[model samples]
Target: MPEWMRSFGRAEDGAVTVDWVVLTAAVVSLGMLAGVAIWGKTGGAAKGIADYIGTQGVDTTPM
Candidate 1:
């Protein structure tokens, strides 16, 4: 009913900001998901490599 309230209701700036916030959140969420997936795969591979290296004998004799 007030003049300021009517103008605020018709404003478009806040709407654009809201859209951008939602889009950014979606992108960040996807990145996190990809990171988690990659991390799981790499974590296993890393552990395997560590185990292999740990089992190898070290030759310390001078050539």
Candidate 2:
């Protein structure tokens, strides 16, 4: 190989940018999953509370 070509064909030492991008993507995905789970539980809890209140004859209609 020509000396000029050899210099241009050097192997990369490390790939910090790619590693960071992958890690950030993983964290974001996990966070979104957790948020969805928590949101579902919260909605269920709210529904249960509303049902209990209704059973107790509490008037929930807005004035």
Candidate 3:
């Protein structure tokens, strides 16, 4: 029933900080999820490029 206690309960000075922290965490989690989703495809594409390069014949001659 104290005024100070009521004010403390109603204080919202840190609300923005909390919101920023939550939003940053959400963004980082989403980025990680996207990276994980693309991880396998990226590796496969890189390997395919490597295989294609390996299969190509290289001619070494002087001009």
RMSD vs true structure, all candidates: 1.6, 5.0, 2.1
Candidate with more favorable, higher lDDT: 1 or 2: 1
Question: Which digits, one per residue and each the tens of the lDDT, describe model 3 over residues 1-63?
Answer: 999999999999999999999999999999999999899789999999999999999889877
* Each prediction's TM-score versus the true structure: 0.81, 0.60, 0.76
How does each model score on lDDT? 0.96, 0.88, 0.96
Residue range 6-37, candidate 1, lDDT tens digits: 98898887888899999999999999999999
Shift in Å, residue 3, candidate 3: 7.2
Per-structure clash totals for the candidates:
0, 0, 0
Q: Any idea what lDDT model 3 has?
A: 0.96
For model 2, how does the per-residue alpha-carbon lDDT over 1-63 read when each residue is reduced to its tens digit?
899788667845456887889999999999999999999999999999998988896579999
**Model 2 bad stretches (over 4 Å):** 1-10, 54-63
User: Can you tell me which runs of candidate 3 are displaced by over 4 Å?
Assistant: 1-7
State the number of backbone clashes in model 1: 0
Clashing pairs in 1: none
Model 2, position 2: C-alpha lDDT score:
90
